[model samples]
Target: MLTVMGATGNTGKKVVELLLAAGQQVRALGRSEPRLGALAAQGAEVLAGDPGDAAFLTRAFRGASAVYVMLPADRESPDYHEAQRAKGEAIIQALRESGVRHVVALSSLGADQPEGTGLLVTLHAQEERLKALENTNILLLRPASFFENFLDALPIIQHQGINADAVEPDHAIPMIASRDIAEVAARALVQRDWSGIVVRELLGQRDLSYREATRIFGARLGRPELDYVQLPPEEMRQAMVQAGMSETFAGLYVQMTQAFNEDRVQPRAGRTADNTTPTRFEDFVAGLALDSANP
Candidate 1:
């Protein structure tokens, strides 16, 4: 049996669906019952509770052969980093007690760095905590910036005719579709032959600058000259706050963009046999456009 945390989320939902389609037993855990009902209907054992709850995690993870884990950020938390650390500690403790043989952790590209990655520092701490577990196979799927993240910009783009970020328009960065991350996670979970802590980086097809990405998006939307603009840090913070993020969370987001713009987070070039995900930016954009039009 495979237990998936954050099962209602984008990547976790895909992982649950893929596992179910393959006739594998899946326990899907999330904080909401209504959201998990669809997955339950599709042959998943739905567990409704917070993954950070140790009792809930123990119940959800018991008897599972492998597990997929991720510590999702809570924008409303007064101390986001502490919340993440507490949650990560809980998962590690639960995993150690449950005797689960393997874990596929959803981390980011810059999680290896101890500083400067802001929110990703939590994932770095998670990796360190998980590394101390003996006789457990841990797979760290470190994906670059998600193409799905751009979906959050759709409202501004549609209304203002521009995409905004703190990063420069000309700065190229690797972006992967969430589906690719899910695919890699599912593949890793099923392969019980592999053991030890393995780190894999998922880069979609190529790295493209925000300017280039805007051009592609414009072409697909039938707008030829849609562009990306770099907002000042304060402007970025205000925008995030207006979007309902807390001031602290907004500041951290701005810090992340600063790191990206300054090229502090560069894409790693190592190729692993397990890192062969092939979703292109054009394909991802087309799907997002369709989802937006329908929604």
Candidate 2:
């Protein structure tokens, strides 16, 4: 049996679906019962519990040959990194006790760097903890900025014909679709032949500057003149706060943008190859158009 944490999330849902379609027995864990009901109906054994709860994780990992692990960040926590570390410790303890042979961890690019990568420090910590497990094969999936992240900018793009951020307009950053990340995760999970820790970096197609991305998005939206704007850090923070993020969380997000803009949050060469996954930005946006038209 394969256990999937964060089963209600974007990548997790795809992973669970792929595993189920392959006739693999899936145990899906999430915090929301209503959200997990769909997966349960789809023939997954759904468990509702907090990921950081040790007893809960132990129960979830029971009888599973391999598990997919991901930690959802708690921006409202007073000490976010500490919370993440504590959660990591719990997951490691459970894995050691449960005799699970393989672990597929959802980490981020730049997770190998010890410093300067603000929120990503938690991912690095988790990777470190996982490495200490003896006889357990671990696959670290380090994906770049998700194209689905731009869904938050959709309202602004549709109304104002602009895509804006705190990062410099000319700076090129790697981006990948979440579907691609799921595809890689599913492949790794189903093929349990590999042992030891394997790191995979999912960089979609190529790196593109925000300006170039704006032009591409504009072309798809039928607004060829759509523009990209770079806001100051404080302005970006305030915008996030006004959009319903806590002040502390908003500030952290601005700091993350600073790190990205300075090129500090990039990954070194790991096990990256040609991933045969579909759903590029244009294709994703085209689906969005269809959804909007049908809705």
Candidate 3:
């Protein structure tokens, strides 16, 4: 059995689907039983509980051949770092207790640094904790900024006619679709061919700047004149807080953008076929256009 945490989330749901389609027994974990109903209907053994509870996770992980682990982002948490750390620690403890020999963990590109990566610091710590597991094979998937993140900008672009963020508009960075990350994670869970710890960077099809991605969005939405504006850090933080994120998480979000702008957070390995995923920003934007149009 392959156990998947965050089973109802974007990547996790897709990972569950992929595993089930491949004829694997999957234990899908989520916070809500109702939310997990869809996966349960699809022939997965659904386990609903708090990921921060080690005992719950231990029960879910037991008897599984491999597990997919992640700390889903919580922008509303008053202390995002503390919350993520708690979940990370619980996951590690459960993994040790369950004696799962193989794990495929979702992480970020900047997780190599112990500090200054803002929200990514949790992932860095999680990576270290996973590495300490004796007699376990762990694959750390370090993917780029997600393409789905741009969907958040759709409203701003539709109402204000511009894309905005704290990152430099012209500073190209790797961005991937979450489904692509799920694809990698699913394959790794099934193969389990590697021994010990392995770190893989999943860059998108290519590096793209905010300006470039905005242009792609404009072309899809029929707004050739649309532009991307690099918002001031404080301004963006306030906007994020107004959009319902906690003040602390909003501040960390801006700090993470600063790290991106300064090149502190980036792909450690240069782009290669092995690391470059197939989904392009254009493809993701196309789906975004369809969703917005239908919604």
Candidate 4:
């Protein structure tokens, strides 16, 4: 059996869907009972609980041969880094107890760094912990900044009439669709394709900038002349805080953007068909525009 954490999230749901379609036995888990019920009705063994609880997760991991692991992004956490570390530690402990021998970890692009990657430092720390597990075979999927992150800018654009972030407009970064990440996760779980420790970089169709993204969003929304602006670090942190991120997480996120602006964070491996994903920024923005119109 294959178990998936964050089963209600974008990547988790897609992974579950793909696995179910492949006629695999899946245990879908998340904190939301209502969401888990939907997966249960679709023929998955659904569990709803806090994954940070080692005992609970141990039970969830029990009887599964492989598991998809992630520390879901939680902006509301009062202490984001501490919370993520706790969750990661719990996952490690649970895996050790349950004897699930294969794992597909959802990690970020800059997670290779031991420090100075801001929001990614939590992931970096967790990756190290996962790497130390002797018995478990681990595959870490280090994906680029998700294109869906652009959705967060919709309100800012609609209200303020500009595209903005702490990262400079000219800085191009690798971006991927969550669906692509899910595809890799589902395949890794079902195939058990690699032994020992493996890292796969899932870069999107192209390197894109907020400036170029602004043009796409404008074109998709019929705005024609929208502009992209780089906000100061403090200003960006305040904006994210007001938008519901904790002050600490917001500050860390700003630092991550700074790392991007200064070219500190980048893909560790060269591009290949194995690492590239198909979805384009245009396709994502088009879908986003449709959702906005329908909503």
Candidate 5:
């Protein structure tokens, strides 16, 4: 059986669906009863528990041939780094105790550095902790910043007809769709081809700047003159905090944007066929626009 953590999340739910369609036994883990029941209805064994609980996770991991480990993003956490560390340590213990042989950890780009990569610092530590698993083979999927992140801007766009973020507008950043990340992760979980610890950077089709992206989104949404605004880091942080993000995570997010603009946080590896995932922003935005129009 394959156990999937964060099964109620975007990528994790896709992972469960893919595994189930492949006729694999899937155990989906999450804390929400409604979501878990939905997965149960979809042919997965649902285990509802806190992923940060070592004992619960150990039980969930037991007898699994492979496990997808995704540490869900917590914008409201009082201490995001400590939360990441605590969850990482718990998963490590669960992996060790359950002897789960294969793991696919959902990591991000710039996870190799000890500092400077704001939100990714904890991911670096998690990678190290997973590497210490002597008997387990692990795959670290370090995907680029997600395109789904852009959805947060939709409301702002509707209100102001502008796309605003801390990300540098002129910088051609590597952005990927969550579906592509889920596809690669599912393939890795199914194939189980690698041994030891492996890191794969999942860069979407090509690099795209927010300037280029805003134009495309504008065109798609019938707003040809929509503008991309790169808010000042402090302004962005304040906006996010006012929008319900904890001040701590908002600061970390601003730091990450600073790192991005400074070129500190980037993929250390070049793009390869296996690492370059399909799903261009244009195609993704087309679907997103259609969904929004219908909904």
Candidate 6:
């Protein structure tokens, strides 16, 4: 059996669906029973509880052959870093206690650095904690910035007529769809072919700048004149806070964008055929446009 944490979330839900479709027994964990109802109906054993509670996680991990784990983003947490640390510690403790031999963990491309990467620092620490497990084999999937992140801009674009962020608009970076990440993760969980710790970077179909992506998005939305604005860091942080994110999360988000603009955080191994995923930003935006039109 495979256990999946954050089963109701973006990549986790996809992983659960893929596993069930492949005839694998799955235990899906989430914070809300109601949100997990669909997975339960689809034949997964659903467990709802706090992921930051070690005992709860231990129970959730028990009797599973492998586990798919990720740090669920909580934008409202007052102390976002501390909250992440607590959950990371709980996951590590449960993995040790449950004796799960194989783990597929979702991480980010900039997780190699121990500091100054803002939100990504939590993932770096989690990677280190997972590596300390004595008898377990772990696969650390370091994927690029998610293409899904752009969806958050839909509202701002609709109301303000521009895409805004703290990053340099012309600076190209790797970005991927969460579905590609989930596919790689689900396959790793089923195969369990590697021993010890292994890291794999998942770049998207190609490197793209925010400016180029915005043009594609604008064209898709039938507003080819839409512009991308590089907001001042302070202004961006204030906007994020006004949108209901905690001050801590908003600040960290701005810091991360600064890191990106400075090219301080990047893939260590560079892009290769093995690391490049199939989905293109254009394809992802096409689906997004269709969904918004229908909705």
Tell me, what's the RMSD of every candidate?
A: 1.9, 2.6, 1.6, 1.6, 1.6, 1.5
- Name the candidate, 5 or 6, with the larger lDDT value: 6
lDDT of 5: 0.89
Query: How does model 1 score by TM-score?
Result: 0.94
Estimate the TM-score for candidate 3: 0.95
Superior candidate under TM-score, 1 versus 6: 6
Q: Residue-wise lDDT of candidate 5 within 194-258, one digit each (tens)?
A: 99999998898899998898888887778878899999999999998998998889999999989
Per-candidate TM-score against the hidden true structure: 0.94, 0.90, 0.95, 0.95, 0.95, 0.96
Q: What residue pairs are clashing in model 4?
A: none
Model 6 lDDT, residue 99, Cα: 94
Q: Give the lDDT of residue 295 in candidate 3.
A: 18
Model 4: number of backbone collisions: 0
Best by TM-score: 6
Q: Give one clash count per candidate, in the order shown.
A: 0, 0, 0, 0, 0, 0
Q: Give the Cα-based TM-score of candidate 6 against the true structure.
A: 0.96
What lDDT does the true structure give each of the candidates?
Answer: 0.85, 0.82, 0.91, 0.89, 0.89, 0.92
lDDT of 1 by residue, 1-295 (tens): 9999999997999999999998899999999999999999999999998778887898888899999999988886767788898899889889988889899999988888888877778888999998899999999888888887776777888888888888888887878889989988897788765789888888767777889987887777777688899999899989888888877788878888888888777546554445546888999878763544422
Give the Å shift of residue 268 in candidate 5.
1.4
Please list the residue runs of candidate 2 whose C-alpha ends up more than 4 Å from where it truly belongs after superposition: 155-161, 218-224, 270-272, 275-278, 289-295
User: In candidate 4, residue 238 scores what lDDT?
Assistant: 95
The candidate maximizing lDDT is 6
Pairs in steric clash, model 1? none
Clashes of 5: 0
